[model samples]
Target: MDKKKPKKVFVQGAIPPEKIANSIANHQSKTNIGAHSIFLGQIRADEIDGKIVTAIDYSAYEEMAEKVFHEIRESAFSKFDMTCCHIYHSLGKVKTGEICLFVFTSSAHRKVAIEACNYLVEEIKAKVPVFGKEIFEDRTHQWKVNK
Candidate 1:
């Protein structure tokens, strides 16, 4: 992985399970990495005020969000002894039980991978300029707030 180059982080819709599997498989030849930590953020069927959420339509200022994602990756690399890191988030509608975000961190040790993965997830949620509209089963929608 090129540590200095910015990576593409956005996917058009829900992240595919095959992509996640391929990522892990591709890393098998990197003998130096002894551990990997992964985080998958799935949309939930949340109930609020008698309405049930069916999906989330995510949107973002792509250019700005990519910049922030690069900064977060750089920060993680500086703080953790990680060998590789990857982050992908959905750009369109993702239904309940579908993955909207995927974060993977690899390191020589389990703790570093785990900690870096956690850091990346938290930073992305707090710093990225992404927005989501929660779509209810009745077709009503409301802006989502990251909690």
Candidate 2:
């Protein structure tokens, strides 16, 4: 097996929808893969105490976050019998309805790709050192909680 080096996961801001499509297009030449699974995390306009959220400003302990992301990638590679995987996350202000995270996995069949995609999402949520500050419509903000 040809194991590749770890890739940088953080983007300056929100991930673009075109990036997602281009990623899939990039893999079209790899004929050995028959299935691909993707997971996209979008910011939500949540209501709290009558304030409506407008966007989220994400922050991370960059060094630690990158290290953790590498670890998660390694773990997924080891655990899943898959062809490839890619992960990208936002590092700055991402408005509601914008994409923040994107994970893509490919395999010879549907099961491995789907399972690996799910695994990566769960691991990223539980293990990454990323934080989000919810910005409300009136410019008020608060820390976000994953639930």
Candidate 3:
């Protein structure tokens, strides 16, 4: 029987840190990885000018988001000497200080893992078709695509 390659991409709704950690551990065990780097993005309650953001409503052009995310994974693999990658972003509502995105990368060495993690996060932020709604303390909301 042929062994399956480690997951090249992971996309989900409201991914938890524990789940992401588990996936990373499982991938590390399957591959002889010497390093794993992770990026965790959290929602912040901040006052943008005069508006205070209270919570976030996350939505995606699901088909387009998936397509873009997969393309990013493939490109990351091609560009970096990494063994595996995972990308997860929240759906529906995510409150302040909760996780919104998690990107994990494992490689045979620390340098590649670190660089790949950074690159993957930047690429995803720039390319994914996910949109976020900033809910203010006054109960008003505004949708903004990540920039």
Candidate 4:
């Protein structure tokens, strides 16, 4: 096993396309990994009940969110032989069809990369304190991931 330092976790106000692409590029340079898996989560304008979602407002308990994100990074390292990992999530309002979360993972083999990416994403969603509001086209709103 190589003594590789973990990548930083970015919980930001908004993340642009370049940042996501750059993160993947950054991780690629460090790993001799043959496989890299990336997951980008974008908002969708979907009708919930009768309201069509027009935008998303993301809010987080920042201190806890960062704490959880770091835990995820460490967990990913412990669970997989991954070469590197990067995670970024938006913190403010993101319009319809905009990306809100990005997860990148790389490994020496394809299987580990894929599994680690999925696991990391799932853990973040399940444990993180980030909240999102779904704003409808009619100007009404509802919280996302309310469950």
- Candidate maximizing lDDT: 1
Per-residue accuracy of model 4 over 1-147 as CA lDDT, tens digit each: 334454445555556888887876676566487999899988889889988998888998777788788888888899999887888888888888788889988889999999999999889989989889899998899888744
lDDT of 3 at 129: 76
- Cα displacement (Å) at residue 54, model 4: 0.9
| Candidate 4 residue spans exceeding 4 A from truth | 1-14
Candidate 1 lDDT at 140 equals 94
lDDT of 3 at 46: 83
Better candidate by TM-score, 2 or 3: 2
Candidate 1 vs candidate 2: the TM-score winner is 1
lDDT of 1 by residue, 24-106 (tens): 99999999999999999999999999999999999999999999999999999999999999999999999999999999999
lDDT for 80 in candidate 4 is: 97
Please report, as a residue range, the 10-residue window in candidate 4 with the lowest summed lDDT: 1-10
- RMSD value for candidate 4: 2.8
> Superposing every Cα of model 1 onto the true structure, what RMSD results?
1.6
TM-score, cand. 3 vs. native: 0.86
| 31-129 per-residue lDDT for model 3 (tens digits) | 578888989998888888699888788887777777777777888888898887777788887878888888888889999999999998998888887
Model 2 segments more than 4 A misplaced: 1-4
On the 0 to 100 scale, the lDDT of residue 31 in model 4 is 44
